[model samples]
Target: MTVLVTGGAGYIGSHMVHALVDSGERVVVLDNLSTGFAWALPAAATLVEGDTGDEVLVSRLIAEHAVEAIVHFAASIVVPDSVADPLGYYRNNTVNSRNVIACAVKGGVKRFVFSSTAAVYGNPDAVPVAEDAPLSPMSPYGSSKLMTEIMLRDAGLAHGLGHVILRYFNVAGADPQARTGQSTRNATHLIKVAVETALGLREKMAVFGTDYPTPDGTCVRDYIHVADLIAAHMDALRHLRGGGASATLNCGYGHGFSVLEVIETVKRVAGVDFPVELAPRRPGDPAAIVASSEKARALLGWQPRFDDLDTIVAHALAWQRKISAEGR
Candidate 1:
C-alpha cells in the first residue's frame, strides 16, 4: 500500500514527503506545480504533476498506487488573498477538497490526514483555543478549510473513512537537515519574510498591524517547527491505520510569540539587522490565536523536539542560506 500526498512539492507538504519516504513508506505525490517545485521531492517518491480537484486523475492514482491513505495539503492558503478572492478560494480549497474526499471514499482509501488551520477560530474569544472552540472564520481561507472539515466529518460517518483533522497553528522552520523548507516565492509567512530580510534577499520586511493588542502590539502566533508538524501528520496516519476513531486535534506548542519577538529572533539567529516597517493590518488576519494542543499530545502522542523559538529560526535561516547559495 502507498500513501498519496497532495501538494507534496510545496513547503510543508514536501517535508511530509521526506519524512514518509525516510520511514520507507511508499509515497505518491500529486501537485500542480503552481507554487511547488519538482526538485524539492526525493527520488524515492514519485511525483504526478496534476491538480487535486480532478477527481478522475485522483481516482486513477488511488487505483494505480494501491493507495490506502491520503495526506492532503493542497489548497490556497494566503489569508489576504482569500479575502480578496473568496470565490477562488472556495473553488480551490473547498470544492477541490470535496472532490478529493469523494475520490477517497469511492477508491476505498480508509485513512485520511487533513491539513487544517487555526484561522478557523477567527480571533478566538480566548487564548489557547482548543478543538471545541467556536468556528468563526475571519477569512475565506479559513472558511474554506472549515467547510472541508465538515465534509470530512460527514464522509467519515457515512463512508466509514477513518480520518484525522490537524488544525495547525503557525508552521515554521525547515526540515532540520536543510533538505526542504519554505521556498515559495513571495511568501507571506512572518518568519519567512523576516529571514529573507535578514539574508538581504528582501530590502525590508513589513510588520503587519502593530496595534493588534498583543504585548508588543503585533499579532502573536504559535510557531511550530515544520519537522514537528510533519511528525504530527505521521502520528495521525498511525492513529487512523490502527483503527482509532476519527479525531480533530490542534497542533501547536500551547504558547505564542508576537511578530516583533519572531523578527528579533530571526535577526539574532542570523546575526544581522534589517529594516522593518510597520503597516496596517491585512484583512482576514486575527489578532492572536494560540493552540491548546493537549489533545494532540495525549491522542497522537506528539512530542515536539524543536519547540524552541531560536532553534526554529536557526533552521529557517540555514535553509534560506542554502537556497540563496544555490540561486534557487
Candidate 2:
C-alpha cells in the first residue's frame, strides 16, 4: 500500500517524504509548488503537481497508486499573513482539508496523519499545555488548523476513518544527511532566519516583542528537531495501520526557550554574531507556549533523539551553509 503525502515538497513534508522512502514505503507526493521546491523532494517519490482541493485528481491518484494512507502537510502557515488574509487562510487550510478528507473517504483510505501546529493553543493559561487543552487559537492560521482537526474528528465518526492529528510546536533543523532542508527563500521560520543571517545571506534578523512575561521578555516556544518530528508521524502512521484508535497528540520536548535564547544559541553555534533588532510584537504571537508530550511518548512510543537546542541550530546552520555554497 502506498502513502500519499500532500505538500511533500515543502520543508517538513520533504523530511517526512525522506523518512517514508528510507523505510521502504511506496510514496506519492502531491504539491502545487507555491512555496515548496520540486528539487527538495527525493527522486524515489512520484511527484504530482496539483492542488489537494482538486478532489477528482486526488481520488484518481489514490486509486491508481493503491494509496492506503495520507500524510497531509499542505497549508498556509504564516501567522501574521493569516491575520491579514483570514478568508484565504480558511479556504486553503480548512476548506481544502475538507476536500482532501472527502477524497480519502471516497477512495477508502484507511489511515491519515495531519500536520497540525501548537498555535492552536494560542496563549495557553499555563505552560506545558496538554493535548486536551481548551481550543483557543489566537490567529487565523491556528484557527484554520483547529477547524481541520474538527473535520477529521467528525469524519472519523461518520466514515470510520482512523486518523492522527499531531499538533507540533516550533519545528526546526534539517535532514541529518543534508539531503534536504528549509530551502524556501524569504522564509519566516526563526531558526531559518537566524541561520541565513549567520551565513551572510541576510544582514540581520529581528526579535519581535522583548517585553513579554517570560524570563527573557521574549516569546518562548518548544522547538523540536524536524527529524524527531517525522519520527512521531511514522509512529502515528504505524499506530493507525495497526488498528489504533484516532488520536490528537502534542509533539514537542515538554520545554521551551525564549526568542533571545534561541538567537544566542544560533550565534554561539555558528560562531557568527549576527545582528538582531528588537522590534514590536507581531500580531498573533503568544508569550509562551510549551508542550506536555507524555501522551505521545506513552501512546506512540516516540523517542526524540535531537532534543538539544545547540544541536538543532548546528544542523540548521550546516544546511544554510550548504545552500550558500551551492548558490541556491
Candidate 3:
C-alpha cells in the first residue's frame, strides 16, 4: 500500500517522505515545487512533480501507485501573506483541499491525515488549549485549515473515511539525521527566522510584538520539535489503519516559550549575538498559544524526546548552517 504524500518535497513533507520510504512503506510524492525543492526528496521514493488540485493527475497517480492513504501537506502557509491576499488563500488552501479530498474518496482511499494548525483556536484564553477549545480563527490561513477540517468531518459521515486532523503548533527544527530540513527562501516561522539571522543569511529578525499580557510581554508558543510532530502523524496513520475511529489531535509539548527566550537560545547555541529588533505586534498575532497534548499522549501514545528549546534550536541551526555552506 503506497502512501500518497502531497508536498513531499517541502520541509516537513520531505521528512515525512524520508520516514515513510525508510520504514518500508511504498511512497509516491506529488510536489509542485512552488515552495518545495526536488532535490530535497529522497531518491528511493517515487516523485511526481504535480499539483494536488489537479484532479485528473491525482486520480491517475492514485490508481497507478495503489495509494491506500494520503498525508496532505500541500498548501500556502504564510500568516501575513494570507492576510494580504485572502482570495489566494481560499483558492489554494480551501478549494484545492476540496479537490484533494474528492480525489481521495473517488479513488477509494480510506485513511487520511490532514495537517491542521493551532491558529484555529485564535488567541486562546487558556494557557494550554485543549482539544475542545473555541474555533475562532484570526487569519485567512487559519480559516482555510479549519474549513478543511469541517470538510473532512462531513466527508467522513457519508463516506467510510478514517481521518485524523493533527492541529499543529509552531513546528520547527530539522531531521535528526540531517537528511532534509526547512529550506524555504523567506520563511516566517520564528525559529527559522532566528536561525537564518544566526547564519548571517539575514542581518537580523524582529520579535513580532512586545506588549502582550504575558509576563515576557511577547508572543509565547508551544514549540514542538518537527520530528516529534511527525511521530504523531505516524501514530495517527497506524491507528486509522488498525480500524480506529476518526480523531482530531493537538501536536505540541504543552509548554510555552517566549520569543525572546528562543532568540537567546539561538544566540547561545550559535555562540553569536546577532542584533534583535523590537517591533510593533503584527496583526493577527496572538499573545500566547500553547497546546494541551494529553489527548495525543493518551490516544496516540506519543512522548516527545526533544522537547527542549535548545535542542530544537540546535537542530535548526545545523540545518541553516548546511544551507549556508551550500550558499543557497
Candidate 4:
C-alpha cells in the first residue's frame, strides 16, 4: 500500500518519511517547501512539490499513486506568529486542512492520520491533560488545529474514512541516525533555540516569563522526542489500517520540564553555559501544558524510548552541530 505524506519534507514529517521507507512501504511526499527542505526527505520517497490546498494537484497525486493513507503535517505552527496573523493560521491550518481532507475522502483514501497539537487544551486546569479534556485553545494556531479535528470527525462520520488524530505536545529532539531533524530557519521551538545557543549559533537565548506559577517560575512543557512522536504515529497508522476504529489520542511523555530545567540540561549535555536572558511572556503562551497520553498507550501500544530531558537535548544539540558542520 502507498502512503501519502503532506509536508513530508518538514522536521517531523521527514522523520515519518524515513520510517515509512525503511519499513519497505511506498511513500509519496507532497510539500510546498515553505518551511521545509526537499533534501530532508529520503530519496526513496517520491517528492512532489505542491500545496496541500491545491485540490487538483492533491487529487491527481492520490489517484495516480494509489494512495491508501495520508498523514498531514503542513501548517503554520509558531504560536507567536499565529497570534500576529490569526487569519493566516486559519487559512493554512484550518481551510487548507479542509481541502486536504476533502481530497482524501473524494479519492477514496482508506486511512488518514492528522497532526494535531496539545495547544488545543490551552491552559489546562490540571497537568497531564487527557484527550477528552475541554477544548479551549488560547491561540489561533491551536484553534486552527482543533477546527481541523472537528472537520475530520464530521467527514469520517459522513463518509467511510478512518482517521487517527494525534494531538502532540512540545515535540523536540532529532532522528537517532542523524538523518533528519528540526532544521527550520528561525525556528521558535524552545529546545531548538537552546541547542542553537549551546552551539554558539546564537549569542544567547531568552527565557520567556520567569513569574509563572511553576517551580522555576518559567513555562513547563512536556517535551517528547521526535522519534518517539513518530513511533506513536506509526502505531496509530497500524491501528487504523487494522480495522481499528477512528480515535483522537494525545502523544506525549506524561511529564514536563521547566524552561530553566531544559536550559540547564542543554548546558550539561553540550558542556556549554549558554547565556540566557529573562523576557516577558509572548501572547497566547500557556504557563504549562503536558499530556496524559494514557489513551495512546492503551489503544496504540506506543512505547517511548527517549523520554529523558538530557537525551532529548543531546539529540537536538547533535543535529544542530551536524547542520553547522555541513554549513546548512
Which residue runs of candidate 4 sit more than 4 Å off their true CA positions? none
What lDDT score goes with residue 279 in model 3?
92
Better of 3 and 4 by lDDT: 4
- Per-residue accuracy of model 1 over 285-315 as CA lDDT, tens digit each: 8999999999999998999999999999999
Error of 2 at 151 (Å): 0.4
Whole-model lDDT values for every prediction: 0.95, 0.95, 0.91, 0.94
Task: Write down the TM-score of every candidate.
Answer: 0.99, 0.99, 0.99, 0.99
* Model 2 regions more than 4 Å off: none
lDDT for 143 (candidate 2): 97
Model 2: per-residue lDDT, tens digit, 279-324?
A: 9999999999999999999999999999999999999999988888
Regarding lDDT, does 1 or 4 come out ahead?
1
Clashing pairs in 4: none
RMSD to truth, every model: 0.6, 0.7, 0.8, 0.6
Candidate 1's C-alpha runs over 4 A off are: none
Which model, 1 or 3, shows the larger lDDT? 1
Comparison by TM-score, 3 against 4, better one: 4
* TM-score: model 3 vs. ground truth: 0.99
Candidate with more favorable, higher lDDT: 2 or 3: 2
Q: What does candidate 4's lDDT look like per residue over 1-328, in tens digits?
A: 6999999999999999999999999999999999999888888999999998899999999999999999999998999999999999999999999999999999999799999999999999999899888999999999999999999999999998899999999999999999999999889999999999988889999998999999889999999999999999999999998999999999999999999998988888998787899999899989998999988999999999999988888889889989889988
